[model samples]
Target: MMKLSMLCCPLLLALPLLAQAIDAGPASPQQQETEGWLLLQSRNLAASPQPQTATPTERELALQRWLKKYRYEIPDFYDPDAGGKVEVKK
Candidate 1:
C-alpha cells in the first residue's frame, strides 16, 4: 500500500502537465488574414483625413449634432448666450 501510494503521487502531479501539452489545432488562415486586415484598416482610419475647412455655421451645427448625440443634460445656470457653458445637475 505504501509503494502504490508513492507511485501514484508522481502520476497525479504529472496529470495537469500532460493536459496542458494537448494542441487545440492551428488557427485558420482566413481568420488570421481578416484580423490583420482589420488592424491595418483601423490604423489607417485613425490617421487624420485631409482637413477640409468648414464655415462657422456648419461648425456650430456639427457641435449641436455632437451634443444632441451625447445627450448632454444642461443645468439652469447654463446660459447658451454666455458661451458654451455645460452644466450638469445631479
Candidate 2:
C-alpha cells in the first residue's frame, strides 16, 4: 500500500495544475525569414533622405529582388498544399 501511495502521489498533484489552462494557441512556423533593405548615408547631416533621382544599380536591383523573394514569398515557406514535399522557390 505504501508503494502504491508513493506512485500515485506525483500524478495526483500534477492533475490540478493542468486543469487551469487557456486554449486556442497559434502554431508557429517551422522556418521563418526576415529581410529588409538599408541605406547608408554619408556623415553630411544635410544630405538626409537623398533625392530619388538615381535608380538602383544592377547589383542593387539583384540584391533587392533576392531579398523580396524570401520576404514576400510566404507560400514557399509555409505552403499548406505542398503535401510533405516543400519546394524552395528560387
The model with the greatest lDDT is: 1
Which candidate leads in TM-score? 1
lDDT of 2 at 22: 58
Worst 10 residues of 2 by lDDT: 31-40
All candidates: TM-score = 0.34, 0.22
TM-score, cand. 2:
0.22
Put down candidate 2 lDDT per residue, 24-84, tens digits, no spaces.
5434342221111112233344464667464568778888888887765445476576667
The Cα RMSD in angstroms, rounded to one decimal, for candidate 2 relative to the true structure is: 14.0
Candidate 1 has an lDDT of 0.81
Clash statistics: count for each candidate? 0, 0
| Residue-wise C-alpha lDDT for candidate 1, range 4-47, written one tens digit per residue | 99999999999988876645643788877888778888888645
